[model samples]
Target: TPTQAGHATIFPTGTSPGTSSVVNFAPGQTVANSAILRPGAGGQVTVHLETPMAAGTAHFLIDVSGWISTSGYEPRGARVETIEPVRIYDSDLSGGNLTGARKVSLQIRGAVSTDGGAAVVPPLDDVVGVIVNLTGVNAYGGSRPTHISLVPDDFDPNVPAQQPTTSNLNLVPGQTRANLAIVPVGDDGRIHLFTLQGETRAVVDVTGYLVRREDDTRGGRVIPLITPFRAFDTRLSDFHAQPLGPARAEPWSFEAFVNDVKVDGEPVGKQAGLLGNFTAVDLERPITWYSPVRTHMTIYPHPGGGGEDENCGAPPNISNVNLGEAEAVPNMALLRYGSSGMGPNRLCVFNLAGYVDYLLDVYAVVLTD
Candidate 1:
């Protein structure tokens, strides 16, 4: 079923009710949301949908992209390490379009500069997977919709890798959109991008990487929750039902134990990082606004809690989501905690411009062993 406007939350079965990972959809539109979920003992997860329209007016679908396991004969488990967002590839710099049915390969390991010759944060070796923000620049402007597929870089360009059924980012004509993706890398430390239809430029920004636990002792092992938890929402009555005003930053805190799941024996407040989905909603624009406002939301580790301070200083260059007026968009983020005085399990959200409400649904925690 389709609805005028609706949202759905997914979490582990039998967990007490709370906002988890949320997918918000507009009228007459089919939007897909993704989140990492830990199944119950019976390998089950639950989805809760909320809509203003009648119950029968809404419908939902679920798909499994991949899974993590250690019980199999070949036991494969990996940990994640966050890095400063780095631009690795941009088709525009090469003066070409990522034409349909074509594959472009980009290096992932030990990279120093972008394809445009800009310096970037280099990733470590032995990376099994990478989390990136894939942007599809609408070079060929029109009203048509298209998609980009990310694949393992093990095929030759002449042969052309088979495009997967799933797409990493969906693009609308004349609109540049980005989506976060966790893609596996080839044995040679590279990944491939393929366009499904239409000619468009592509951009790949690396945010984090995954490696086997034994291979690297620097990162944090991922602890998937039996159920995703709603860490914070500025729209809820109890959680302060007010939109974050322009140029404001707010810090929200979380406990180590969520739904009776503990990091270790003691309450370990400090964590290496958190894995979750961040959604920006109800963006407010000026009355005279005509053009699409380019806005962004940044989530970073904050030192303290409560109240806004003009002296809070400028936010880092990293952003979680690019926002537009009256659009609700969600992106997956892997955020690292501050090493020094920053409080434990605390993160701050900063809005670049305009008032906006945001939601955070955490699916996993990163623990340094």
Candidate 2:
């Protein structure tokens, strides 16, 4: 037999380059040998056997022994809340060691590709599942979380997340799942990023990825993409309207008046930009905090600025007050209020319910600070 097919071998570490050989195949039939794989310093060796595979009928094994860091799993679907892997700060809650009285924000960026690529938009009415991890710390310096409070950006203050009413968690250290799950209703192709913070334990950030719908579609390899949009904190002067009393003890409310409210020295001014349902997060993502042109509805305690006096009510004295230039930040905002009312008076606030919008409310009252 002259040789059904020629074969060659190389011994770089031993003797010759192409002297010794192994004849390992027959003619008219394709063949492949498992490769001899070894670990290298950030390196690899691939041996390509001259073989032709059938229509999806080929298998080979390559043994590899190497060291690599463990990667955190990525989550997906309009992520209302997500954690980033950046260690922003660390504090020792022991010995009452306060770490500079800081406020943290949390947010979930929309989905992104694994390779930091472009955004992918799925079909409408397609629902994606979401997950949240509540990272904490333990007494033994282990990884865990104490408590987590998740509030969606579009939530009504009357209906917020359930907090630990008694003020703490009742669990042994190191035994808790740091996560929450929510399936929101929308087709904005966004990730539900949740902003979070902690009082006692250490915290970890979250990353997100997505999975395809469960419908019977063609199964193929698709890459996930992240379009991160963050939510920052904003200081709302009169954020809360009256707490919708009878339902709430001290009814917290918000309101605005026509001649009663003036902005930039103009009656019925448009200077008061509404901070409609502002949201904050301990995470670092960009959020377009909505600023209202005019509040939902306009209400007043007493018209003519003295109508409340007949009811034994003192007129609201809002003077010397000037709202500084309106500027928006990641998680914070500023609105200046000074005194410009009739006399040194008392101001009562109300939520904007009967006056304008369904979700608007007047929340605060300051004399002249």
Model 2 RMSD vs true structure:
28.4
Model 1 lDDT-worst window of ten: 303-312
Which predicted model would earn the best lDDT? Answer: 1
1-369 in candidate 2: lDDT tens per residue? 212433322122322222212112333322211111112234433222333332122222332211211132232322111212222122232232112112233223343322344432223344343222223333344322333333322322223352212211111333322221232323443332222222334342222222334432222111110111111112232444222211111111123331244324544322222111111111111223633221111111322234223221232211101011121101111111211234222122222211111122111111110
TM-score of each: 0.79, 0.20
What C-alpha RMSD separates each model from the true structure? 4.4, 28.4
Candidate 1 per-residue lDDT over residues 1-369, each given as its tens digit: 455677777777877546554666666665555678777647887777777755536676665656755342232666677765667777877667776566787777665446345434345555678887777766484335677878775554344334566777666666556677888877777888877667788878777777665554434556676656677788999679999887888766554443244645544333577788888888886444555565788777654433533233456555667768888888778776542244355567889887899988778777664
lDDT by candidate, in order shown: 0.68, 0.24
What lDDT does candidate 2 reach at residue 74?
Answer: 30
User: Where does model 2 exceed 4 Å of error?
Assistant: 1-105, 109-128, 138-146, 151-198, 202-215, 218-369
